[model samples]
Target: MRTRTARHAAVVAALLLTLGAPDVAAAPAPPPPDAAGTADAESAGAALVARRAALAAASRGGGASGLDFGACPAVEDLPSRVRCATLRVPLDYARPDGPQIFLTVSRAAATGARGAARQGALVQNPGGPGASGMHFPLVADLPGWERIAAAYDLVGYAPRGVGRSAPLSCRDPAARATGPVQEPVRPSPAYKMQRLAQARAYARGCARRAGAALPYYTTPNNARDLHVLRAALGEEKLTFLGASYGTYLGAVYATLYPRHVRRMVLDSAVDPDPRRVWYRNNLDQARGFEGRWRDFRAWVARHHSVYGLGTTPEAVQAGYERVRDAVARTPAGGTVGTGELRSAYLQAAYYDDVWPDRAAALAAFLRGDPSVLAAQAAPDPAAAAGAENATAVYTAVLCNDAPWPADWGTWDRDNTELARTAPFETWANAFLNLPCASWAVRAGRSPVAVGAQPERLPRTLVVAAERDGATPYAGAQELQRRLGAGASLVTETGAGSHGVVGGRNGCVDRHVERYLLTGGRPGGAGPPGAADYRALRAPRRWFVAPRLVAVHGEDVGSEESALGVS
Candidate 1:
């Protein structure tokens, strides 16, 4: 679910809100009391201490059987009602006493007793294989989510190797600084050699830094950890809402523990095909992004009077290429080159609301003002560690969960072919994942056979955006079919965004709310055999003014940064 470039760095930082301490094995030493910490750090530390205390208090009730929940330390912007706890689980399921890791869990309790009685807990994951879920409970404050919050405890947790868990830090700071930018369309042989060398070095860094824990970071293990958390929470069955990569995690959980699942909602789903585990999925993403770019071009064309970039899609595209060429010749802000330009504007593919901003930025750059480009290119010092942790976890999980071709030739041939059709992101995506070819840890097990036994699972709801660049719409349709009679597919027919749930589509949100709250699904109201669901053709304005869908009066924006599309 990795995005094309550094723009997603902001998203990872925003969503990596930590509510508890990192597991002892991987926790970093605390900064000196005199040292200034970001507000995010201070709040995360305080909440973690409080959560540990609560977990200790709960132990008195029944050891690990009853979770003694208590108020989280007051963090700015976090809902006052949310409670936090830390649950320790076996680092390796095969050896329960070998070592221990902790998962930080948060819950926004149901509003009333009756609502609480209907559904016990609604566990959630916000899609990054690396993204933190500590802040997820805050969604309870949103409009449509109030009913859900009233009906079930909104639960969120940081997965094993993510923030405030046993976080992984593998990349050398120097390596990251010197990392190669997106490759040119037709790079020289020397450039290929240089990137491959960097890829190998990166793989070595992970092996040296992550060491033992790297082997256990696969999706199945994360699913196993979910089961343990479920038991600790005293829930007989799991009810979950997972977006982006979270959807893949949910599917694996249902497949592994079908009977343990009570209900599930998967938005922006990953294709479960083993062959497309990651490498191929990224290739598919290349194609999706190309289409999304075309959409962006069309939008720019529509606003030609304002942007003055072009009056047609082709002209707009040409304008973009001109910018790329100019940046390549002389880097803007001394850092923003063609790669930076691509990364900055790629946001338009994820959410339509950003189209205007992106267009404005592009127009400014074309008009001899590179400030916008420079501002976007500047890296955030505060997000450095979180970004490293996310990159580590993302690589660990994807590399270890399934096999990748060890030969560079396979990648070269495949990427070359993909570039012929989907040039925007093919090379970038290929290089981003190149390290997997030389990953230190071998593929631990076969990719989870997702949708392997969908009939054995309970009723589930699947939502997808028609032109979603990250998780393409086809994957959602395929997942729905695999889930068979028990699953319903809700399509945002023309929406290009990656995340659909709670993104202000009343039609989609209502269906999600109904399914989660009352166990009611969209009936067979569409044409016969039409996936047993409805399709909402998003309004044109839906693309232009995404803020209209802000939840709880605050824009949830796009989760694309946190959850890489495919």
Candidate 2:
């Protein structure tokens, strides 16, 4: 069913330069339960042994036997050397002798790595339990990614419930809610009730269609898959680079299997304060969006000559309201509505790269060219499909990961109050997550205790931007508080990009590369409390490669951020 809230948090899906599904392989049923845990564990252990051996052989350019090292499918934008294969893992680890699902894995085998040193397999996860990492390795094609690609076998995979793997779906075109935001929002009790019903219906629809597998779609399980991937790749310990929500996934993997993590880099760290796993994390996101929205408004105001919107933020906002009012009254080209326009604008808050195009698109409309507005506001169903799938997993993981406020009253009051200060993303975000109130799967499970015990975990490095509205800078600070005894925080000042490393800030990239390439301390990296080790700050300049700039008219300066691609 169509709904007022199609997908929220465009930032999650929008992160990596904007980045699907295969039908072929249905997972084979697990070995008979009569064979039980021990036998399955033994069998899995043996398979890992064989996989590790075959992977080692492949690494040395030896015969590729045992491992399914074949050419990757033609569909992906992968580096030439990248190979694709599949790994089977139990849907629920607790019951290993049960249903088994296949996870599509890709690898860019190391080339002439510097020092001829192969740092084992560098496993990656691009956030979203929905964000398919199948092509995350594609980021290797980016300018500065060459070194990491060469030093370690870059690995990407579709999380269990994403892509070719046992994908989840809750989409019902019939369930789509009608009408766009018709007027300036005046949130009333009746309006709240209407949205709440949409949220509930969406939740119910998910259960009706995909309820059976919802319980197992979680971060802990995701982390386990990484562990299995590590073993499959013949790595003694996992070398991981995760961004955004992937940071949370990595952290969980570390906590659950710390001894197995050789090296880990978490970019744009998520707030790990157990108290704010998701429910609170999202509210904080609204404020971040509000702040980014201001930056965008000011940018548009600055380009008043080009956009003809206004010369001040207030004037720019007035112009926005004009467009909003027009679309609310009459949908643009019979498709772009208040909701679509708002979602389109939401992209600006995610990345400044789109500000010019987005502003120009809206400006053309204000100038009586509704076609420009219509084209700008047109929905991408393909994107929407991926997002809804991601949303499906987002809800499943978030709802199953920890407890959310089950009472609508709490959500209503909190979001209503928050809207007073940050209206741009508040209610939209609330609706995005409101399904949790009626989630078919019960929550209340405590989130992983990330920094509670860092002894087993290696000294980790976290990169974050002061203005990253997606995860927020507070998360980095919080990570330090918890892992400070062993971790370092790289703070990118004055930047608002989501993830920090694929090819963003040189300073942050240097730190990450040095850490990954050289292993631990004596490699020029200091102790956890050392100057740069503890808190490394980036220069003010951004490096925007032409390919990274997708704005219309002029570019947002000659700078770009990383492909955090999570």
Candidate 3:
């Protein structure tokens, strides 16, 4: 394996060459010597307490801001008792009074506790740079989080350039959003060119549609807006729960406003190393996904008695390749492409809960049924629209935050090189972000130095699944290190799920719930020399098909099982 130092140096060099400027921010200073580190840890802990006290003193007797609360717009997933409202913030912080954009924010007020007992707001984000998190307050509805909901008002929002908050669009809303099957690559120069063209066209569309607001839709600005949301909600100190890309946002918020963080839970952390902000991060994801994909292949092989695809991992790969080749040769039902098939299976890599269904789909298709594959690829009009917007916002944020390799050659070279080793979805993901090479706006800003002032941060709980592809475990480790002695990592060992906290892992949830509720942390829960916790289990939901609805084994009425498994 390549050393992190070597990887860092290589990526930085590529970034400099491509951007024609130094975009990689310097990493924070190394950890102190053991004896000094111990002293520093003690002093940092003392400093944190004093800082919290000072902040509390400064904001004594402060109450809610004047922002009016109204009933949230009803959505399918949101529970009752949720309130929402819109707030306006500057489009660009540089010129605060220049232009204004609105943000939609939601909150589920504490139900378990009253005034003095309530623990302020517990804000959360659900990862997408493009994904809308307006319903994240729904975390309050989870099994172990009800108490947390009672103590802290669960807050959620649609960050700038996502959802109803000045949404970014790169296509004509009236134009049919073609849900084409853009498959994984095979090192073909022609396919490479097609992706480049598509990316360039996409870039052009964003430039024409996104207009001047494009440049400001960045991570730093997003962090600043979060602070504004904090003020609007009248929270003196922030208690954050962020997952996936959200982990990065929360980290940046802490970096800029460390004094304001009361508590933070970063689940499935993004690498804080500035050099890997995005370009390198995607490459890392390709490798990370490869490992999980193998796990999935192994699982399917174990269940060969049912699916009959293969009896071993290597055999499973052969089956997968055959299925992939079929999709490419003839788009399933003229709708699904090899790309769409690969994309669908990619979900299984993120979370194994989909494994049974995904494998079943493959089995059905291999048996001469294209309906299963075609249905999966078919686009729901509204979902497709939302996906398009997300792609737009995702592009804007990453491109604006840092410089990507300027030339198509760099992308082609890098991705093609990566596909050789990690072939699953390398080309698919590569083409997805290829627009960055031709982005409309250039913020010329480097990603924030998240760990620059480690001492100022509170004792944050950073969680990760050891085998998470989206936000790999190594990134979480790096994050904990940068967070200095105050941070304790709680990694779910051998678990490949992207985000695991509320996904039904008791051990992980116990640690998270205890921390969010009783100010607990996860130290000493890990094996010696490992992370603070080593979660060993994964969630598996297998609903055996039943012909009758039973009330404690007494049949009330006959009902067909939704899942086909009998």
Instruction: Estimate the TM-score of every prediction.
Output: 0.82, 0.81, 0.81
lDDT of 2 by residue, 75-97 (tens): 65444567888887777655555
lDDT for each candidate structure: 0.70, 0.69, 0.69
Assess candidate 1 and give its lDDT. 0.70
- The residue-by-residue lDDT of candidate 1 on 1-566, one tens digit each, is 55423323333233321112212212122221211222567654663443333323332332334455677655323445778877776666545546777777888878764435556788888886898887777766555677887888888888998877887878755446643144475766688778889889888888888878878788877876776676667666688888888888888877766656777888888887777888888888889988998889998898898999989999988888887888777777777777777777777777666787788878998899988877876555567777888888888888888889999989988888888887887787888789999988763446766766533456677877778897887788777766655677777665677787773477778878887876666655343234332334444463353322211011111222211223
List residue ranges in candidate 1 displaced over 4 A. Answer: 1-68, 71-80, 113-118, 173-175, 178-183, 525-566
Residue 435 of model 1 has an lDDT of: 91
Question: How far does residue 503 in candidate 3 sit from its true spot (Å)?
Answer: 2.9
Residue 388 CA displacement from its true place in model 2, Å: 2.4
In model 2, what lDDT does residue 360 have? 87
**Top candidate (TM-score):** 1
For model 1 the local lDDT of residue 294 reads 87
> lDDT of model 3 at residue 324?
79
> Tens digits of per-residue lDDT for model 3 on 43-157?
6455334333322322221114444667777652444566887867767654544677888887878886444368778887777788766666655554566677778887878
Model 3 TM-score relative to the real fold: 0.81
TM-score of 1: 0.82
Q: lDDT of model 1 at residue 56? A: 31
